[model samples]
Target: MRKSDYRKLGGIVILLVLWWLLAYALNRHFLFPSPFAVGKVMLCQLQNTAFYQAIIMTLSRCVIGFVISYGTALVLALVTGHMKWLRDYLAPLITLLKSVPNISFILLILIWFNREISVMIIVFFVLFPSFYSSFTNGFDAIDQSLREVMILYPQSLWRQIVKVELPLLKPYLAASYESGIGLAFKVGVMAEILGQVPDGIGKKLQWSYLNIEMAEVFAWTIWLIILLVLLEHGLRLLWKKRKE
Candidate 1:
């Protein structure tokens, strides 16, 4: 196997061993469940249709929110990246969003909207700045010489963006998405928890922890990690294909 495969296997083994040791030392399945116990719960959860629905629901919310953020950020970046004065207009708002606490956004939005809408709004707000900064940075890094060359071609600014600038930013956007997906997934789940939205991983986590079902909680966490890893791999594959 490759070095990366060996590394992954070694990490899993070490973590499992540590978990087992911790559980044994604690000697209480309720507080600190063993890996095996969590695995059992995970297996049971896998057999439940509700678990699948929860995963699907959470995934849908995450994707939808990220898509909205991504599209809006790209538009803003395209506009502000070339216009210095406009950056002044948006900078304070973006700074505020970036600086403010996530819980504050969740709480305030929850007051204005229902739980489901609040969760979606929270996800969008949490992720927008990161993606916006990534997009703007990508645009800022475009070569000035290339812009001058495009100027010689007699193409309009719109044509140059479509033909040249956007193409250059493809890799940057792909890299952002490849990493941003995980961040977005985590934040979306947090939103779900704060919003008290049902049929999501966060909701299941809340229920499990409140009922003192540590094993089930850990099982749900493991499932989330598995899902995130799968998504990261999928994004990697997609990025690779786009590069080729």
Candidate 2:
């Protein structure tokens, strides 16, 4: 392994040690379960079908929310990128969406929509501004010289977009996806918990919390961290492969 890998492993080890020490000192299994206890719970959960169902439901919601937000942002950015007046007109609304607290969105959306739809909408609200900003910034940063060259040549609009705009926008889109996917999952789960959706990781967490199953809570949390790390790492690898 590389030196960095070893350092990361060492850090994890230190954290586990600290966690164990704290749990031992507290001597309250229900309040602060040890790593071993949590690990055992995780193992049991892995054997259960419900755990997989919850994961799948949550992942589906996250993906759907991300796709909707990304597509909407891409379309709006493309239109507004060329229309300064429209961009200015939408600026206040974008700022409102970006500035509102996530919990506030969750509460308002819960009132306006059903529980499952509320979760998706909450994810949308949380992610749309960031995606839109990234895309518009990318559009604005595109080289004016290239556009001038295109104008001089007089290519078809589709050709110009395909050959010029999309190529330039790729990095921005990839960056937004990398950053936004995790946030989507987080916000979706939070909405699920607050909305009390029938089945999801958030619902499982709520159930565990209500039952005071601290070990299960810790186990679920560990799974979430692992999934997020795996997802980010997988995306980085895919992006690297695409570049190659």
Model 2, position 86: C-alpha lDDT score:
100
Off by over 4 Å in 1: none
Candidate 1 C-alpha error for residue 30, in Å: 0.8
- lDDT, candidate 2, residue 53? 94
The per-model lDDT (C-alpha) reads 0.87, 0.91
Query: How many collisions between residues are there in candidate 1?
Result: 0
* TM-score on alpha carbons, each prediction: 0.94, 0.94
Q: How many clashes (backbone N, Cα, C below 3 Å) per candidate?
A: 0, 0
lDDT of 2: 0.91
Q: For candidate 1, write residues 1-244 as lDDT tens digits.
A: 9999999999999989999999999999889999999888988887899999999999998988888988898888998877989988998999999998878887888889888767777778988998898898899889889878776877887987788888989977887787778888888888788778999999999998789998998898888899988988887887778779
Best by lDDT: 2
